[model samples]
Target: MAVLVVGGSGFLGRELVGQSLAAGHQVAATCLTQPPDLVGPAWHALDVRDRRQVADLVTAIEPDVVINAAYRKADWSSTADGAAHVALAAASAGARLVHVSSDAVFSGAAVRYDETSVPDPIAPYGAAKAAAETAVTAICPDAVIARTSLIIGDGGSVHEQRVRALATGRMSGVLFTDEVRCPVHVADLAAALLELASSDHAGIHHVAGADAVSRHELGTLIARRDGLDAAALPSGRRAGTDLPGPLDVRLDCTATRQRLRTELRGARQFLGH
Candidate 1:
């Protein structure tokens, strides 16, 4: 099958491109800036915030499936408006869509969320993601809205890098013991997303890890895996801080898990003790 992966330069996006190539699929990928060094995908310079550009690119490629993994945490135009543009283009091209979402849409008041939970975002990023989800759902009825969490790789994820930086005193920040999330491996997430894209399943699907761990605990795990000093990785609490976000948001992926052939391993399982 021919596939289009948006945000090909990103950590998760890179994995998606690689996996698609390995599956022997004809792949086209888009990047906001320069394309990556990966040789398999046909690369395009796309600004998803630009509706005409998005539509034109999708029109030119005419891919069978479009998997949107593009997002900017601080920019609403990139996160929300971009999603709508991509959705519109995919729908117009009659292509299947799998739009990636985040567990940040939850406010943590419920603590644990499922596919049925309504988004009640507290921060701008979360709100933007929620908006993206809404647009994708309404625009593409057959699209899969896969809401994942804290995508960790072998060592390439931002969070994992942050942990390494903190342990070596290259960065200065405390991993909040109270802030928790179900972190999914990048490979697993990318594979599951591809699996979902190829399937007929539609609507909201929670595709996070099985284990819900605090940021500090997650950092310690990273440190352990990387042979860093776990004690040097400072821990703190986000509860009393001025941070405007959830303290604990764990997605319940039981229903989604039953439908997928990919195994979404937990951080502990993937990273080890």
Candidate 2:
């Protein structure tokens, strides 16, 4: 199958492009700036915000599947317009669209959220992602929406910075033990997405690690794994309960396991524990 991956320069996007190409599929990817080391697929400089450009690219690639992995940088705004534009373009080309979303769409109140769970995003980022999900599904009912959580990999964005801070003993004390999340590996997530794209399944799906870990626990795990300090530095406003609303977002991947017939790597296992 031929596939088009948007935002192929990002952490997860890089892995998806590599994996798809390795799986004997024709892959075409797009990125804003120069992408990381990519060899197998055709890389095109694409700005998803430009609807015409996105549509033209997809139409030219004529891919059997289109994966919308691009996202706007987290800022004060709370909407994912670029990602939605990719979905719109994919739908215009009549290609199967796969929209990557976040577990943050939920309010994080539920102990376990399934595909059927309604989105109640508290943060602007989550709200924007939720809006993007709605747009993709409403436009193309056949499009697959995969809601995942914290993605773990080497030298990405969030995880890498945290590790660096710990190594330098510059890690602040503002840690949130209240925030619980399931972190999935980039490779595993790409595999599951490929399976879903190859199949005829539609609607929303939750793909995540097998277990949930609190923010403090996650930080400590990464610190210990990398042989760094795991002690509290100093408590700040961000350290207390008044910190950004912590969500206990643990996704239930029953449908994903049963339908795709694949096993997801647990957070501890993925983190090299």
Clashes of each: 0, 2
Query: Tens digit of lDDT per residue, candidate 2, span 80-158?
Result: 6676677777777889988999897888667689999999887777888888898888888999999998888754648
lDDT of 1 by residue, 1-273 (tens): 999999988999999999999999999999999998989999999999999999999999999999999988999999999999999999999999999999999999999999999999999999999999999999999999999999999898999889999999999989999999999999999999999999999999999998999999999999999999999998988988888878999999999999999999999999995
Cα misplacement distance, residue 108 of candidate 2 (Å)? 1.6
lDDT of prediction 2: 0.79
Q: Which stretches of candidate 1 lie over 4 Å from their true place?
A: none
C-alpha positional error of residue 48 in candidate 2 after TM-score superposition, expressed in Å = 1.4
Q: Best by lDDT, which number?
A: 1
Q: Indicate the TM-score of model 1.
A: 0.99
